[model samples]
Target: MKNTTDKQLLRRATAVHRDMLKQAEKFGVSASQYDVTKLLHTSESGKVKVLIDATERLAIAIAKRRRIIICEK
Candidate 1:
């Protein structure tokens, strides 16, 4: 049961990450080049922040599953 839920979460996160990349490309920038904080509108910034946070959390979860340590400075 837990494994199934994790798989679903992983799928969702992958989809979101792909979509974000596509959006950045539409703006003539790669996902790594896109700056979420530079958005002029507060709401848009907040929404992007939430998505980024979720994606980070998902990455951490995946790393843990593989017994990998993610060091943050």
Candidate 2:
């Protein structure tokens, strides 16, 4: 199997984030564009995968009117 580059992983994560944002907006919330440097240096999997995952989870919480902290890069 080919190794997935960090950039590629981040791209995929961003797509997930975008979808999360749409859901979040319905709850009157939004997301921030995390700095590239922070993402690049993120401690998880050489990309911001966990961050996006957390964002998705946060969106779910937002939809349910639950309060959650966003982990910005």
Candidate 3:
């Protein structure tokens, strides 16, 4: 059961990461701007937390960029 739980967590993390990357691309944010190398060595829970934090940061950046673009127009 623990193994199954771990797998689920990993899957969720991967999905979140993929979505975050797609959103970043849409906003013209380079993937290289975020450091994900450490994720591989982190625990499953840690990976999720890190990814969630990164996603929130990306969302904020995208919002700011949109506001700037709207103001420029």
Candidate 4:
């Protein structure tokens, strides 16, 4: 049997991943504002950094939720 704590963490991770996907779609809606030509000239590092930040935020949110679950348990 899977440990309750492990199962809880898995569920939390899945939920956060879904939320991140929704957030990504929301962010994609604003892509029309960028000039493709100018964007092509911009460094990829900037885009990578933004993705990293979003990922980090999602991770932090998941960790916080997990902590809450542990406290409740």
Q: Mark the regions of model 3 whose C-alpha exceeds 4 Å error after superposition.
A: 35-38, 42-45
Model 2, global lDDT? 0.57
lDDT tens digits, residue span 1-73, model 4: 1467655654554455456655545444222222122342355334433444555665555566657767988
TM-score of candidate 3 versus the correct structure, residues matched by position: 0.66
Q: Give a tens-digit lDDT track for model 1, residues 4-70.
A: 7655664564477666556545544335533333442455223544556755654444445345332
- What is the alpha-carbon lDDT of model 1 when measured against the actual structure? 0.49
Ranking, lDDT, top scorer first: 3, 2, 1, 4
Clashes of each: 0, 0, 0, 0
Q: Which residue pairs of candidate 3 clash?
A: none
Model 4 misplaced regions, further than 4 Å: 1-45
Please name the candidate that would achieve the greatest TM-score relative to the true structure. Answer: 3
Report the poorest 10 consecutive residues by lDDT, candidate 3: 35-44
Worst 10 residues of 2 by lDDT: 64-73
Question: Candidate 2 lDDT, tens digit per residue, 1-73?
Answer: 1356766767777677667766666655644542233454546553565666666566666755534343422
RMSD of 1: 14.4
Clashing residue pairs, backbone N/CA/C < 3 A, model 4? none
> All candidates' lDDT scores?
0.49, 0.57, 0.68, 0.47
Residue-level lDDT of model 3, residues 23-58, one tens digit each, is 778877775556463565655347666776776777
